[model samples]
Target chain A: MPVTENIYEPVKAKLTNIIDESPLIKTLVLVPEKEFSFKTGEFIELTLNGIGEAPFTPSSSPLVKDKLEITVMKAGYVTGKIHQLNIGDVVGIRGPFGKGYPLEKFYGKEVLIVGGGCGFAPIRSLLYKLIAEKEKFKKVIFCYGSKTPKDCIYKTLFKELRNIEKFQVLRSVDMADEPWDETIGVVTVLLDQIKIDINNSLAIVCGPPVMMKFGTIRLLEMGYRETDIYLSMEKNMSCGLGKCGHCMLGDYLVCKDGPVFTYNEIKGLPDIWR
Target chain B: MEITVESLKKITFFKEFDSVTIEKILKISELQEFDVEEKIFDEHQKLIDIFVLLEGKVILGINVPGKGKINLGTIHPGQLFSWSALFPPSISTAYAFADVPVKVLSIKASKIQELVGDNDTFGYKFMKIIGQTLSKRLSDTRFQLINMASV
Candidate 1:
């Protein structure tokens, strides 16, 4: 593959809309000056000009080239600053780094998606791809968990997903508040309630560290193969390119080689869940 | 609701039990239903029957002095609740209520105790399942505690 000459340069993008997902998370819609396309699970470096840049997986569908959507959680200084920006502010976007979810491998198989918190961002993108090519897969099961009902992002998307044929959306809140009618437990518990043929299914997990660890363990117990379990790992990725050692997971660079990897690929790596 | 061995076999908790054992358990169990928000048991209340959720959701909570009812976890179908009845003291650890219209297989704790005492194999298998359930709940509670502390 040929590399782009201006790998360091960023294309300008105008923030078009902001959707307040939760108290601490927001989804920013941006219209890039140039058509930008990325695969479902790829990560992009979003620069706030002089403030700083952070890596985020686009929450919008990869098919939408004219614009991108990034879901942001107010976790640190850069994100806190990003949260303060209003509509019409311009931001810089660099490379659509890392290998993405392999859509072809998922064809003719059941797709099980387990996500929590802001991890729903990338999974949402993948969901869009799956929905567009719904005939390719046998079934899709999404199990999501949040701290509470108020903390759940993409609340409206669940209803939309449920309407799609061969798609099942199940949600759980670690704690419950009034007017909430769904399962209440950790996200892994949803695994028990779902009936899937483990042999013909692919399990995808993206979440906070603790959840990712436990969710993987639960999937393993449910008879999912290590090679069939894919995890979206988040690391301190300073550079979207592999040159920066900031995002190294064992010998692999999370930014370049993967933000998406099968459990078989990373199980031996130390502190992967963290 | 009619209680059948076949239906009991469908539940994860009873799946390992033989038909004869399920029949024995069925003799000591009956189907019970609760309306939405109906309190099934309170913390410190003497538990007489252990329940396997047949359908709907159950919210387990603890009553704090000022916080009132603080829901800690949810019980899903095919899962067991109120295992305190199987142990000594037989008092509930947390209060449980119907999060929705709920159905459960209520098993008489004393009869289960009698069955366990009489059969060593049945006792071992039953205890093993209970142990697994407790282990899972412990991990879940630890996860919830970490989540609360972080928040």
Candidate 2:
């Protein structure tokens, strides 16, 4: 079903800071006047008036309600304009649309979160949520990859997340050069370093098309059932409410049917980017 | 893991075919490759074999008089297309082109008929797969038509 509603709620947030995640990507942390509550995998449509708007996942912990955060990669027109916005700038906020990861399922279950490049945003949110309630989950393993260390968003957060007692953070770069000492290759390669109890664990994947394609297959090979693999899809989501058809992945609309879907639910959908 | 006849036979539609029969069927099918932007099957072309896309994207297009080229839909991996010749009239109504470099396996229509003639069970299973393909394409066409009408 298409999302027929567009509830425009005004939110005033002071852009506390902007961290340059990479040359083309940045994270905007906003301390809103009021609390902004959202699930990790859900997204918000940020409006920039004349420049248009784009959909992004607020990568802040669900536990933190007074602040909002979004990691954005500068890809084309709208995101380019978004990159120009500075701290203290006011931006339009439209939604906390689409359901987040099945956090309830992860309770008492080991979870694997895999991501690549700027695709790491939503995965990071999932990671944070799991970490906030660490006692609930058995273990959390995060595997992330990017073209280079320079292009890795949330590069700093990796160190902090690794320091967490219950979390295992592994990172890789496609091609390594400058002073890099870590795993290298596609994100799937890191799957080798981490052990997954596929039967008892859930895998949440969000990344570029190529990354998810192989990641899903690898997870399946590791004995994870198709139903247990949750994929975060990326599409041209203009209206987070699913009014816009830009995010159509077969009969299902990515904005509504999912930004997050179980592999079994979407394996039959045609033209799935991942 | 091995895509052998045994594995093929496990698919619901291929359940009728035993290991030996499925092996024979695979022999008749040949892998074909198409370069990026290459035409796989043109509209009105006679269908000789059933094309199963194993990889890459295929663009299904139709020409409209007094208008221009219209993209009906696009097919990705695991999806099948160009089945127009499988039914009445036995001629393609739309063209199929490789939007990107593609790899596919083709089973000759004549060979399919032969296999079906020999084994009704195999025939029924094969027809089921074809029927599913046709149903999906019909729905996709309807969606395109609706989008066009709205335009």
Candidate 3:
């Protein structure tokens, strides 16, 4: 993981707009200093001046390169600085580091996407690609969960997204208060609401670690083969390269081999969903 | 409320029962309809009857401190609700309400035990289905509880 020019260089980008997704998250629209291209499931390092840098996936579509969208949640360190930034501010964008989701495998089959909280960031990249090439896939079902109506991200786009033919999007919140009449419960509840052809389908899951762990178990019980399910494993990516050693899960660097791995590939690995 | 053998067979809870058994079960069961927003059962209600959803949706909800009403899960078509009837001192653990116009087949708990006692085979088969559904619900509930507690 030497500083190779291709992987080490950071392209400059400017935040054109800021969207308040939740009280804690801001969706930043970036216009890169140069042309950029990356597939879904990959992430870029967002560097904020002297404050430092952290890894974040572009929640925007991979097909759209003119402006990239990164849904940044205020966790602790680097993200806190990002929340303070205003529009017209500039930041650094690095490698679409790591393997993007394997859309090639999903080309001819039905696809199930299960995401929770900010995990929707990477899944959104994959979702937009499927929408772009709708005819290539059989069916696409998206099951998303948020803590509440106020915490749901991408609310503005999902209404238009549901209009895609042969696609279904099911949303659930942990609790319902006012003016909310849709489903209420964990996102996995959507699995019961929708019917999937387990034999001919693939499930792509990303979310809080607990959701991933339990969601995997539920999918297994529902008869989905372990080989057909994919998970996004986002360990700490300090370098966005294999050199960091900080994001290691077994011998694999989450930044290098994944961000995406089939359940069969890492089933027995320790601390996988921890 | 119309209770027929065919209708009973359509219910997931009674799917394993034979037509004769289903016919007999229907004698002890009654068809129930719930209008939208109607509360079919309340939490901690003392009852020994379980419901099988035939049409529409029922939301099983529990009140969470600081969080208001959190849905335990959904009881979809062919799914069972008020499963406490199968256990002693049965009491509803959550409130069930019609999310939409709904129909269900209700079977009394005492009648279930009598039927099981009459046919050992039916008892085993009946309990097996209940166990599977209950365990799956337990697992999902445990997961949801963890998620809620974690937050």
Candidate 4:
């Protein structure tokens, strides 16, 4: 957030807090030294001094520039280093690269969001954007799935989101041991349990490949046209710019053309996504 | 070939998890149907859930760009497709396609996490199930790589 001299400006983003989404996933809330603007679905590259960088969405809405949040899971090398930073640690940040969700398209329609694991990060940003224009959409339903009750990231705030008048939330897991009150199955299974008007709705899904694959298949089966389904893809997106082929899925570069793509645009691509 | 809990109990990974726990996993996991020669998991796909071979076989493949797809190994019953789903936002390391009419016990990753959260003991037992599958396939992959090099 701090404006400095070089391309690799050392912006002192003070980690305001960390929200544990799950055992290995946490949302790091930071207060930038300066205001940084980004779209609802755009991403910023977070760099740890010695480690490296990874692309992540500012889970916080663009409307709120004073504070920004990037949800990270302790996964690979760079991300594992990100988890090591404490509140008040300084981490370098770059532009809010990539396009965001098409808020204009869902201006007056029902929107269904299906997110899984860390995939919830970008959707959280989109949700915050939609909440600003809550009246624009008739209804918004979030079907989020995590591995366990404890494995479920954002378990605490999800209840608050559920309280939103225009929102309906359902949390599910594939397997439960002792006892779980919520639905127990894949997040796609939540589709069968809910009533959706595919003709008048748009579906946004972000998650692992299998979930997205099956979720998209079920949505298509339920009459949700390919164009109506939007997906946020994940790969080892090293460079936020298209120059690096790390995030290329097909003809499209995830860093440039997407992070968010319509199902129709990517349907012809092998394996359903990039 | 059909595989039941009764048959699985004969394996070491299924030994600790009782019939009930196995039944629960079996009940929650769906059987994915795939056609022969159809890709089950493509290289571009995001890796989320892991697959357990229930019937028939699958080929773990890598796209060599210039040489087309190179078969890493074949997945058989008691083997897995992608165990990386245990970690979130996992990238699919390879392409998985059906070698024959295949049915796999497709377990949603969230369920695996929930089970682990509710009971680590239960989760560890299940991890063992996949871990054994992984080890077996890893050795198989080593063999395949050796064969490829030899040629």
Candidate with maximal DockQ: 1
- Model 4 residue pairs with clashes: A21-A153, A147-B110, A147-B113, A147-B114, A148-B114, A174-B111, A175-B111, A209-B46
Model 1 DockQ vs. reference: 0.67
Best model per lDDT: 1
Question: Per-residue lDDT for A1-274 in model 2, tens only?
Answer: 1112436554556777998888988999887665577877888877776677788888878778788888888888889888889988887766778877878988999889888777888877777778789999998999987776688787778899989988998886654433345654557657755766777899989887767777787788778999999998867676776676878877878888788999999898876753
Native-to-model Cα distance after best TM-score fit, residue A114 in candidate 3, in Å: 1.1
> What is the C-alpha DockQ of each candidate?
0.67, 0.02, 0.51, 0.02
- For model 3, the superposed segments whose C-alpha errors exceed 4 Å read A1-6, B1-3, B64-70
TM-score of each: 0.97, 0.62, 0.94, 0.63
Model 1 C-alpha lDDT per residue in residues A11-49, reported as the tens digit of each score: 899999999999999999999988898989998999998
lDDT of 1 at A227: 98
Off by over 4 Å in 2: A1-6, B1-151
Total backbone clashes of candidate 4, pairs 3 or more residues apart or in separate chains? 8
Tell me the alpha-carbon RMSD of every candidate. Answer: 1.5, 12.6, 2.2, 16.9
**Chain B TM, per prediction:** 0.96, 0.83, 0.91, 0.80
Per-residue lDDT value at A58 in model 1 = 95
Worst lDDT 10-window in candidate 2 chain A: A1-10
| lDDT score at residue A198, model 2, on the 0-100 scale | 74
Provide the lowest-lDDT 10-residue window in model 4 chain B.
Answer: B142-151
Model 3 C-alpha lDDT per residue in residues B26-123, reported as the tens digit of each score: 88888889999899988878877888888998888888789777665677788888989778788889999999999988899899889989998988
- Order the candidate numbers by TM-score, best to worst: 1, 3, 4, 2
lDDT per model vs. reference: 0.91, 0.75, 0.84, 0.75
Sort by DockQ, best first: what order? 1, 3, 4, 2
